[model samples]
Every structure is written in structure tokens, then in C-alpha cells.
Target: MSVVLAGGGSAGHVTPLLALADCLRRRDPATRITVLGTAEGLEARLVPARGYELVQLPKVPMPRRPGPDLLRIGGRLREAVRAAGAALDAAEADVVVGFGGYVCPPAYLAARRRGTPIVIHEANPLPGLANRLGARLTPYVATTFPHTPLPHAVQTGVPLRHEISDLARADDAERLARRLLAREHFGLDLDRTTVLVTGGSLGAQRLNDTFGEAAPDLRAAGAQVLHVSGTGKQVEVRQSAGGAGDDVPPYVVVPYVDAMEQAYAAADLVVCRAGANTVCELATVGLPAAYVPLPVGNGEQRLNAEPVVAAGGGLLVDDADCTAGWVREVLVPLLQDAAALRAMGEAAARFVVPDADERLADLVEAAVEGRRVPS
Candidate 1:
């Protein structure tokens, strides 16, 4: 069967799209996959890198306010829908799968116009405008979070990469071995408790500054820090008056980590933003986390972390409250308490659906075959 997948603009959208495409190919080697995205979006590079045909679409963002830009959107959207429909025809798509992003609205419209089956997977708890609109056009809608308000939304969880998903099944000995290797790879001390601080791929300035300031205190509390400071963003470690001693734990910083599974393995606890993918991956891997939701963007990040925190899997703090003092008071003691960390990690693992990739692929197959998807 041939399929066209639409999503892009950011890693959040592109990552899951690629994951689903990979799952579909693995399930049926004969399947042909085409991706629809803007030429400027991450998908331009990532989709091709994954060896899928990417059909570039003009990005026609739906303007929020009434303005001249809003007036132009209708014409732009018409052109985009025409291009999208042409691409769909060229690919002979039996089904079109959409993850929420700027490219989705046109794709969904084109698929509907052609009477091709459409499946949508929304990765955020708070549905975006594109997916929200797409959900009305199709009965097959899957969601990463359980409570996303979409019609016929199935709680299939997020489609994660195999490398991240496989961590859920690691035996104790294997886990330890992987952890040791990961620590060695990162140049972190194996004996010390490790706290990983990340702000996703682009990095967060607030995270870098706050965590960088607290690094000395964290080391003094007998914990090593592995900080992924984002690409081109440098984190300056602030030492105390006496400066760091040989006995103090190591503080390592890197611009980016291409191999994130290794970083996840090496970390005893993680502190990062509450993006849907990050939350799901951490839960799938049974890693305890302190999630600081991004202060912007319609409050979806906080909503994403709520279920995990409510389920005893993780801790949540607002962006403004995630100060160095808060870290010293909360994170330091939590790191020192190994038993608490174990309990939280177990809770996290229990909350995840590790086989979400397969589940989502099943939905796509059901759509293609015109079979009823079992709820």
C-alpha cells in the first residue's frame, strides 16, 4: 500500500511522523511512503535522510488575529491544498496520516477531497488547530495523551523510536551495563549519582542559566551533572567562593548529544522541559524526571506533565519557579535519595505504552483496509 504522511516544522512533529513511517515499512516492506512538509521545515532534511520521498508544500500558517496576513491566508491555503492534492495523486496514496503541524490542514483537506482515508495522531495533550480540524474529517484519530479533546480519539500514546522504546524491557544486568557504557561515553563518574539537564535539541536559556548556576551546589551534594546545553549555546559553570575541589563530582557540558539513548541510560534523574515526546520517552524508559514546563505556548507543556506528575511518575514546576534555589532544595535531596528515585522510575514506566509505534501502525493499516479499528 502507498501512504502519504504530513507533519513537520519541528522535531516534535517530524520525529513521530518518521517513527510511524519506519513502523509501516518494517511491517510491510512493499509499502511506499511519501511525506508532505514545507521545504524549509525539519522534514526537508529528516524525511530524505530516512529515505522517504518528501513532497514540499508552501507553509500557510493560520494567522491568529484579523489582519492583512489573515486576508492572504485564504489564497495561500487554496494554492497549498492544490499542491497537496497533486502530490497525493502522484503518490497514489491509499491513506494519508497526519501528525499536527502547519502542513496538516492542507494535507487533510486534499485527502478529504480525494476521498482517501485519513488517520491523525496528535502528540500534544492540548490539540493544535490543525489536528483539531482534521479530527472532524476522519473517524480514525489517535492521541499521545489520554484526555486530548478530539472526536473518536484513541489513546494510542506517542510513536517513539525503537532505541528509546526498547529501554522499557532491559533487564537489571543489561541496564547496569548500558548505564556504565553510557557514563563512560559521556566521561561521567560511574559511582556518583547523575543528573541530566536538557532543554531538547535547541536548548533553553533559562535551563542553561539556572542549571549552570546550580551545578556547583549539585556537585557539592555529591552528584555529577551531564548538561546538554543545546547547539551553539554555552553554559558557564559558576563555582562557589572556594572553587571546586577534587572530591567534588564532575560537571560535564556538551552542545548537543546525537545519541540521546546513551544520555538517557547514564542519567539517574532528568530535569527538562515537558514536551510530549520527552515525557513519553522518559516514562517508557522508567526514568524519574523533574519537568519544568515552557512558560509560553497556550499552557500545553504544563498540561502534558500533569498526568505523569499526578500519577507519581514525575515532578512538575512552573518555568518561573524553577530557580537555582528550588533546585538546591528539591532536586539535590531527591538525587541523594536513591530509594525515592527508584520508586518514581517504576511509576514512570508503568504509565507508558511502549508499543505505541506498533499500535499507531495498526490504526494506519486499519484505515487502509477500511476495517473498523478496535477501541
Candidate 2:
């Protein structure tokens, strides 16, 4: 079957699109997959890197307020829809799967015009404008969060990369072996209670500064830290007492980590932003986290972390409240409590639907075949 997937702007959208594409390909080697995305978005590189044909579309962002830009949106949308329809025709798409982003609106409209089957996967708890519009067009809607207000939405969870999904299913011994190997790879002590601090690819300055300031305190609490400060973002960490001594827990800081699966494997706990992808990934891998939601957008990040935190799988902290003092008082003690960490990790693993890629793929196939789409 020929399928065209749409999403962009960030990893949260593109990552799931790629995961679903990979799952579809694995299920049927002959399936043709085309990705519709913006030339300027992360999909420009990621989609092509994943060996899928990427059709670049003009980004048509909906103006939130009445302005001169809003006046021109109609014309811009028309142009984008025209381009999106042409791409759909070129691919001979039997179905259009949309993950919410600026690119999805045009793709959904174009697919509807062509009488193509539509399937949408929303990764955020709060639906974006693009996905909300897409939901009106199709009944086959899949959601990462159960509470997302989309009609006919199936709670399929977020589609994760195979490496992470595989990690989720690993046995205890195998997981421990992987943990040891990952720790060795990251130059971390195998026995240390390791905490990983990441703020996604671009890194959050607040996280870098606050976590960096708290590093010495974390080490004093007998925890090692692996801090990914994002590309070109420096985190100044002061070591405890003797700089590289065995008594001082290691506080390794790097700008970026290409192998995030390895980092995930090496971590005992994670301190990061609460993007839907991050939340789902942590839960799927049975890792406990201290989620600091980004204090912007439609407050979707906080919503994303809430269910996991409520399930006793994680902790939620507001961005403004995630100060160094908070980290010292809360995270340091949490790290020392090994039993609590293990229980939280177990809860996390039980809370997520780990096979979302396969489930969404099933929905797509059902949509194409005119069969009943599973909830």
C-alpha cells in the first residue's frame, strides 16, 4: 500500500511518524512510504535519513490572533494544499497519516480532496490546531494520551524507535547487562546511582543552569550525573572536593548525545522536560523521572507528565519551581532511596502501552482496507 505521512517542526512529531513508517515497512516490505514535511523542519534531515521519500511542503502556520498575517493565510494555505495534493498524487497514496504540526493541515485537506483514507496520531495531551482540524476530517484518530479531546480517538500511546521499544521488553538480566555496558560506554561507574539530566536536542537553559549548580550536592548525596546540555550549550559544573577522585561522584557533562538509547540504558533516573515523546519513552523503558515541563505553549507538556506522575511513576515540577534548592531537597533524597526508585520504575513500565507503533500501523492498514479500526 502507498502511504504518505505528515508532520514536522520538531522531533516529537517526526519521531512517531518515522516509527510508524518503520513498523509498516517491517510488517510489509513492499509498502511504499512517503513523508510530507516542511523543508525547514527537522523532518528535512530525519525523514531522508530514515530512507523514506520526503516531499517538502510550504509551512502554513495558523495565525492565533487577527492580524495582517492572518489575512494572507488563506492564500498561503491554498498554495500549500495544492503542493500537498501534487505530492499525494505523485506517491499514489492509498492513505494519509498525519501527526500534528503546521504541515498536517494542508496534507489533511489535500487527502480529503482526493478521497483518500485519513489516519491521525496525536502525541500531545492537548490537541494542536492542525490535529484538531484533521480530527474533524477522519474518524481514525490515534492518541498518545488517553484524555486528548479528539473524536473517535484510540489511546495507542506514542510510537517509539525500535531500540527503545526493544529495551522495554528486555528481561531483567538482559536489562542489567545492557545497563552495565551502557554505563561503561558513557565512562560511568557501574555501581553508581546514575541520574541523567537532558533538555532535549536544543537544551533548556534553566535546566542546564539549575542542574549544573546542584551537581556538587548531587555528588555529595552519592549519585553520579550524566548531563546532556544540548548542542553548543555549556553547563558549568563544580565537582565535589577532589576533582576526579574516586570519592567524588562523577559529573560528566556533554553538549549532545547521539546515542540516547545508551544514555537511557545507563540512567537510574532522568531529569528532563516533559514532552510527550520523552514521557512515553521513559515510561516504556521503565525509567523513573523528575519531569520539568516547559512553561509555554498550551501547557501540553504538563499534561503529558501528569498521568505518569499520578501513577507513581514520576514527579512533576513546574519550570519556574525547578530551582537548585528544589533539586537538592527533592532529587538528592530520591536518588538515595533505591527502593522508591525501583518501585517508581516498575510503575512506569506498567503504565505505558509499549507497542503503539504496531497498534497505529494496524489502524492505518484497517483504514486502507475499509476494515474496523481497533480502539
Candidate 3:
């Protein structure tokens, strides 16, 4: 059967859909999967790389302020619907599964008109505007959080990569993976601890700046560092703090790290944004993290980090208060105490709900195949 896996514009939305698609393909190798995204969405880069066909649509991220932007969004949505219709017709997709983003609203609507089943997956604890709009078009809605308020929304934890699901136990796997990946990928000293820091695919200026400032101190403490620098900041970070270690580059900074499995495997601790996907992935990998939520829009990112923080697996750092000094002070002690880090990892692991991808894949398949999902 054909599945139009619709999601994009952000890594959070696209990541889960990819996980679900991967699970569905494993369940049935004959499953024809196509991704719906715009030229600008991360899917344009990620989907095709994964060997899935991408149906490029014209989509604009919903504007925070409504005015000409809203009008432009409306026009784009109409165009998006038309583009999705063409994609659906060309691919002969039987069902379209939307992993909640701006692209979802139009794609879900097109699927509805075609009498195709539409399944919406909302990854955030709180619903976004696209999911809210898409919810009106379909009765099959799934959520990551248990208490989401959307009607017809069932609690199905966010789907993560198979690599994460297959992670071994705390000491056996994390340590083993960490040692191998750190030495191989970053060429850092395996004798000392390693900290992996990322700001997502788009990267974060604040994170890079803070970490870059602490490069000398981080290296002096015998901690190998792998940092992800935002697009424009890569040159700056490399030119400034990358030359600390004569033999191994003390700190390795890159625009992005595609191999998340390796990164998670290599890290003793993670320091980054508290995006919904990051939260789920951290739990899946069972890593200790110092979370700094992006200070855009509302405090949704901080809210998402709540479950992890409360569980004692992660520390919440408000972006406004996250400074190089604060990060150094908090992480230096945690890194030194291996027992505390292990305890935090165990606590984070408690939040990971296994078989999330399989559950979501099963639900989507059943809905499209006209089989009732398990009650």
C-alpha cells in the first residue's frame, strides 16, 4: 500500500515521520512511502537522502504575527493543496499521514477530498496551529503526550529512530558506544569524558557562543567536546576556539551532525535546545542533558522539557540566563561525578516509551488498510 508521509518545515516534525516510515517499511517492505514537503523544509534534504520520494509543495511556516503574512499563508495553502493533489495522483497514494506542521493542513485536506484516510500525529505536549486545523479534516489524530486536548487525539508517544530503540542497557551500551564513536568520529581522547552539544539542524547562535567561550576551560578539564555550530557561525567557531587541542582539535565544531545515533552514543552528556524531538530522543538514548529552550514564541520548549527535568534526567536552563559561566559551573561538576550522570541517565530512560514507532506505524497502517486499531 502507498503511504504519503506528510511532514516538514522543521526537524522535529520530519524526524518522527521518518521514524514512522522506517518502521512501516520494516513491517512491510512493499510499503510505498512518499514525503510531502516544500523546497524550504528540512524534508527536502532529509527525505531524499533516506531514499524516499519527496513531493515538494509550496508552504510557508505559519507567521507569529497575522497580517499580510496570514493572507500569504492562505494563498500558499491553496497552492499547497493543488501541489499535494498532483503528488497524490502521481504516486497513487492510498493514505496520507501528516506529522503536524504547516504542510499538514493542506495535504490532509487533499487526502480528505480523495476519500483517502488521513492520520495526524501531533508530537508536542501542546498542539500546534497546523495540527489544530488538520484535526478538523480527520478523525485519526495521535499525540505524544497523554493529556493533549485535541478531540479524537489518542496518546501515542513520539516515534524515534530504530537506532535509539535498539540502544543497549545504561553502562554496557552508552559507555561502549560513547568510547567508539568519540574516538572514531571526533578523534577525541577516549581516556577523558566527552560532551556532545547540538542546537538542532538549524543550530543555535546562543549555544555556539556559550560553548565557544568555554573552549579553553572545557579542554583543560580533560573533556573532549563536539559542538554543532549554526550555519553562519561555523566559520566563527572554527576560527576562534577550534585550535585548542594540537593533536585532536580539542573541540570539534560542525554545521550539523547527521549521524545522531553516533552522536548520542558518543556523548557523556548532551547540552542543547529542548525541542520536543530532542526531549524524546534524549530519553530514548537515555542521556543526561542540560536543556536550554529556544526563546522564541512562548515557553513551549521549556514546558516540553518539564517532564524530563522533573524526572531528574535533565537540567533546565532558561535561554535568557544560560551563559558560558553557568554552563561551565553546572556541567563541570556533573561531568566529574560519573555516578550522578548515570543516575540522571537512568531517570531519563524512564520516560522513554518503547515501540513508539511500531505503535504509530500500526495505527497508521490499520487506519489506511481499513482495519480497526487495537482498542
Best by lDDT: 2
Name the weakest run of 10 consecutive residues (lDDT summed) in model 1: 62-71
Question: In each prediction, how many residue pairs overlap at the backbone (N, C-alpha, C within less than 3 A)?
Answer: 0, 0, 0
TM-score of each: 0.95, 0.96, 0.91
Question: Least accurate stretch of 10 residues (summed lDDT) in model 2?
Answer: 62-71
Error of 3 at 31 (Å): 1.1
Query: Candidate 1: which stretches are off by over 4 Å?
Result: 64-71, 240-246
- Runs in model 2 deviating more than 4 A are 64-71, 241-246
Between candidates 1 and 2, name the one with more favorable lDDT: 2
Better model by TM-score, 1 or 3?
1
For residues 1-375, could you state the per-residue lDDT of candidate 2 as single tens digits? Answer: 999999988889988999999999999999999999998888998899889999999888875434687577898899999999999999999999999888898999999999999999999988887888889998899999888899999999899999898888899899999999998988888999999999997899999999888888898888999999988899988666657576787888888886688999999999999999999999999999999999988788999999999999999998999999998999989998999999999998889986899999999999999888786
lDDT of 1 at 345: 94
TM-score of 3: 0.91
